[model samples]
Target: MVSAWVVTKVAYVVISIAAGLIFFYVTSPLVKSEKKQPLEESVSLLINFVLYIWVGKILLNIDVFITDPLAILAYPSDSDAFYAATLLLFGNVIYKVKWKGLNIGTIMSSLAPVFLGSAFVYEFIEVVMNDSTLAWGHLGLLFLLLLFFLIFHERQSSVATAGGIFTAWSLGQLILTFYLPYTTLYGYMMTRWFLVLVFILSMTNLIQNKRLRS
Candidate 1:
């Protein structure tokens, strides 16, 4: 029998494809835009519609950690610190804003799933940050997401806004890897995927509403 982890991961791939088809169906306006874009750019826009589903999940997971205070006190090391550092990294990369004050805010924001989800693996979930496969998967997902965002927007201002948001998010993931244990990390991840599912459903609903209106 497949473990829950294997089952969820497999389910995620199927859900992502479904999300993609729905995105394409709803944003058919973009089909015209695709022809006007560079071939690589067009491919990226399509892929990113699917990726947004995943990113929404990450933000949800961040919320999970924030709601739990004891987890922060108990696992006081680097997870929050790493998020703080990554926020700084993002600030420096995108906005050139480098106030020391924001690290706390970043830490608070990254804490959602760690505090809320009680599930634990053989070890702390954040510990998986040290795992090569996990780290690489996050990095790959982040890179593609950012790339897709950059290509999605029509204007420089929109791209800049996207860059800032993407940087902060990627930084949050970096924090999770360096500080939190395996269990916290797993919770964070699960939270994100759940959020992704919700977001896709919401988007689908909006499309149905518009079709009814027309």
Candidate 2:
């Protein structure tokens, strides 16, 4: 007999997988122009991320992981593992693109729509499951707008589209941080960092478009 906790964890993982698949399916056309399946790349990246996290977790608690390899899957690990995995994921992407000459912009553009779509689905599911109304207004609207632009603005450069979406998202986060209830310190800081990223992306997009025009 499966325990309730195990069932819940399994359900969450299933939901995450389903959400990712749906996101990939919906954004298939964006990558079709390049004869690519962005979701496949996303899944590969995700696998690397999870592998990093799992390894970090195991290394952090080697004795427990070694003793009960199967049992470790049922519980959440340390936040340090999550943070470390996230940093390493970025590093891995940068290493691949910068050193290996991977098409970074194309990958990012392919990923942009799927990112927002998956996020919207996951957040909506969380809201429904938790019966919470915190993120429905601003963040949800931003995701919807991002999806709309990515779907309709096929003529624009992918970098521009991605930058526009990130700008809108940063603006939304800023508003949510200031004007909304249920705000936390971590959320506030994270929003600021997102805004910084938005600025960088916007500048890069501007330069890219300018070069294309010249």
Candidate 3:
């Protein structure tokens, strides 16, 4: 049987994702016209992303899964699973862009709001439900990013805006890690070096987008 804690966590995830979808639709008008994806497409992508994460979890715990597939539901996923999911997601995106002729920029633009919105909701839940004070810092950071995106989204290119938000978020999380007792996102054990790498990648993407526009 699935544990109550697992059920609660899944409920939180569902709530967060719903919040993200609502946020995306509410803010759709502000997104760059050229980068806006259809609602169906965005939903499909999000579903696929969630599936990838589940697959990652299963793969990371293959031993347990092989022994008793039903038992897997009780196991919690960790940073390693997250990394695996991310890599798989990245590969899937690349494949879509290259062979399926999907617009990478549009995908990124469509995903940005949902990602931030979900993150904000998740952190808020952590603070309220779990009494995690550290989550407040992450909540504050996401709130500012969302506000900034709303304020300047109409004026900025979607890729640039997404890149900027990610860069800022990564840097903010990195700084928070120094003073906080644990990692921000899902309380996963993300190392400072990983955050730095994300920061660098986001900054690079932002710069490249600017140069392309110029």
User: lDDT of each structure?
Assistant: 0.36, 0.62, 0.81
Output the number of the TM-score-best candidate.
3
State which candidate has the highest lDDT. Answer: 3
Clashes of each: 22, 0, 0
The residue ranges of model 1 lying beyond 4 angstroms of the native Cα positions read 3-8, 20-156, 182-214
Give the clashing residue pairs of candidate 3, or none: none
* TM-score for candidate 2, residues paired by index: 0.69
* TM-score, candidate number 1: 0.26
Can you tell me which runs of candidate 3 are displaced by over 4 Å? 30-38
lDDT per residue for candidate 2 within 161-201, as digits (tens), equals 76666666656665676666632211112445545565576
In order of appearance, the predictions have TM-scores of 0.26, 0.69, 0.91
lDDT of 3 by residue, 32-73 (tens): 553245555668777776777779989988898998987775
- Model 1 per-residue lDDT tens digits across residues 1-214: 2344544543444443344343333432335554233223323333442344334334435565568743433342233343433344434423422453332222221221111111122122223533544444444444444455435434423323333333444444444445534212322342344334434543453455446546
Q: Candidate 2 regions off by >4 Å? A: 1-10, 13-17, 30-37, 55-81, 181-191, 194-214
> Could you tell me which residue pairs clash in candidate 2?
none
Candidate 1, residue 44: the lDDT equals 37
